[model samples]
Target chain A: MEQPEELIPKKEVLRLTGISYGQLYRWKRLGLIPEAWFIRRSTFTGQETFFPREKILKRIADILRLKDEYPLEELVRLLSPEVVPTEVAHLDPLALAPIGPEGRELLWKSGEYAFSELVALACGAEAIRRGAKPGEARLLVEVVRRAEEALRAPTDLSALLAEKTVEREGLLLRAPLALVGREPLLLDPECRIKVRLDLEKVVEGVKLALGGEGRG
Target chain B: MGERNVTISGAGRIEGGSYGTVKIAGSGRVVGDLVAEEFKAAGSAKVEGNLKAQRFEAAGAFRCEGNLELEEGEAAGSLKVVGRVRAKELKLAGSAQAKGITGGYLRAGGSLSVEENVEVEIFRLMGAFEIGGLLSADRVEVELEGRARAREIGGEKIVVRAGQRSLGGFLSQALGFLFGQGSHKELVAEVIEGDEIELEATQARLVRGGKIKIGPGCRIERVEYTETLEVAPGAVVKEEVKG
Candidate 1:
């Protein structure tokens, strides 16, 4: 079986992080960790638990770094990907690191922004950072905003900025395409890929930025 | 007196509502969801829907059809929950059966049976248990009078003693009548991981921990320890790797 993301065994994770089994399971029960991340697979020895390499490592790191400052319950609110701050009404989306000055060009109007709008702004800002045209960034924002529900489960979601160029006789017409969908996104042979943004990372970044703001 | 006290001294049924104290001395039933400051049931009682109470005490058969959110609860007879049970501290004397139980401290005397996981801060059991999924806690102490089974058991400090039925044959007989007959003082788990683990009459596929002590009558397939490993006589460990 071919997995798109690398996986690490449960034992290896404990050894690498020097965390105890108690801490791992405790975090899991407290919702500091997502239940879906625990992937049990049958190995030659016996049944074993595995995790997505990057996601688990980063989540454990975040928890360890913040556990001292906040209680486990508060840490869940701050760090758990399962917890989307749906009630957030941020006054300045640009102040968030993920949606900085690059988002200025994409902001339609900004008195107060909801969580989904902030995520949209972040997507646009990230696209702009990747050298996308302002219009293209706006298009990506529009594509990602409707999929705000994805932030709760934020896994295997991809945002594609593509172009389909049609040439007839001596004329060439370019149509910029923007779409958000689950991974393994198929495209037409004529469509050239411009930027492929992983929505999971973008969503995590926005969540963390919002969490920081909450604490401050 | 914002008086809302439901007292059913005999066989009766009442709709669920906010009550100061619900005292059911006889067989009774609650129709809908219930939120009460305190609930005291002496005879057989059943809650058809969810229940939220600050304090709860029941003597006879107590059954909850829906989930129960309790601050403190103590039951003398059989307690069964069809859905998950979330309590700050729960003590059951006879037997407890639930879909899932997560709390701060849980102490069960006779038996505990759960379909999913029981994640708590401190778990202490005297007689026996059957957990389909993981049973994890900060500190797990089990004095096995009969047999227990779990898919996986993990914690910080785990100590399982065998045949510590200090209450003698009376309670064991009662427990046998409730749960099952005494087969052996043992625990069966696929994996048992903790910081400090001490086992007696435990059969596990893998036992991973630091400072592990395996006592008599334990049959472990493999043990991977970091600090130290001590196995007493009559314990079978197929493989042990100490780091």
Candidate 2:
């Protein structure tokens, strides 16, 4: 089983990121930060807030980097994973930075692609970037496309490809399976995890890529 | 569409629909949802359904069964909303109650009770409040006349003070019944965080800020500060850490 993701305490996040409580709350109110990211747990000192380590750090970095250029309201549209850019429809999926040339193979019948479709294509493209086979990437895209409902609670969600070996009549057979669910996605003893992708990050990337194009 | 004006001078009952100006002088009850440009009521008025108006003014007892959406609203005696309230500007004089409130400038003179969050640009209260969830604002100023409890309070600049003893009977008797009878005015919260903070007569588990001043009659379990920390003589803090 993969190690559960690290959590950074609220105080530590403020210290490490050099952001004050007011700024954090303001961003939260503005929807630049998702409510699901604020994980409240009862620590020794009453109730304390925590955030996923890598995701919070990356989100804060992106916000701090772009806050100067774009208005905070616009930043919410560009960065928030919870915001699905449904109004976006593009003729070519390869134009987005997150998809790029690697996305060429994920195309099915591409006159115009909706926002979620582009996100699915971007997921497959990202899988390919991580050295997965084209077929495996396609598998991930299919699973993620059906996972539209999962985006409502994007935090701690994972997409994975597992390979299982079966012995039948003294013959060995391999089966590959793709699935998506909340994290700590466990597989049985015979299955081996081939690829794991944090869907939150991929969703953010797709939003950022397509969002700028729409706004600009 | 420009709907006709509706006015109930005395006791009346009306079906809820679109209107221009709705005024209820006496006891009034609406059956369904109301969409109006201006809603005005005096004495006891009740809306069984949702209310959406550009301007809303209520006096005496007013109650809405569904949500309240207004551009600007002011209530003098009592206002109660069963569902959430979204307004650009909300001013409550006597008492107000809601499930949740999200607005711009919110000023309450008397008791303000919210089941959940009260997030606004500016929140200023003169009497008592009990917020089950977080009370967050750009600027939060509370002049406490009675006991107040919020799970968490966060803002840019938060200043809370104990008001001089006035309105002793109505506030004390009403709020005292809710939070148990306590002679001294106090604010209780689990966590209080802000950039610039100063508090008095407050009890909190954790107080965090950039510049924090623990004023008189305060008991805090832990205090974390980045810039400046000052603890008054009467205040008691279990732990103080400057980071």
Each candidate's interface RMSD, rounded to one decimal?
A: 0.7, 0.8
Q: Model 1: per-residue lDDT, tens digit, A1-216?
A: 125889999888999999998898899888877888889899887888899899889988888898899888888877777777878888888899999999988888767788878888898898889889999989988988888777677677788888899999989999998998887788988898888877777777888888788778
The whole-model lDDT of each prediction reads: 0.88, 0.88
lDDT of candidate 1 at residue B235, scale 0 to 100: 99
What lDDT tens digits, residue by residue, belong to model 1 across residues B60-143? 899999999999999988899999999999998998899999999999898889999999999999888999999999999998
Each prediction's DockQ? 0.73, 0.66
* Candidate 2 collision pairs: none
Q: How well is each residue in A1-216 modelled by candidate 2, as lDDT tens digits? A: 677778999999999999988889888877788888889998777889999888889999999999998898889888888877777778978989989999899898858887777778888898789887899889988988888888656778888877889999999998878898997777898898888888888788888887677777
Residue B58, model 1, lDDT? 92
Clashes, model 2: 0
Candidate 1: stretches off by over 4 Å = A1-3, A157-194, B1-3, B179-181
Which 10-residue window in model 2 chain B sums to the lowest lDDT? B174-183
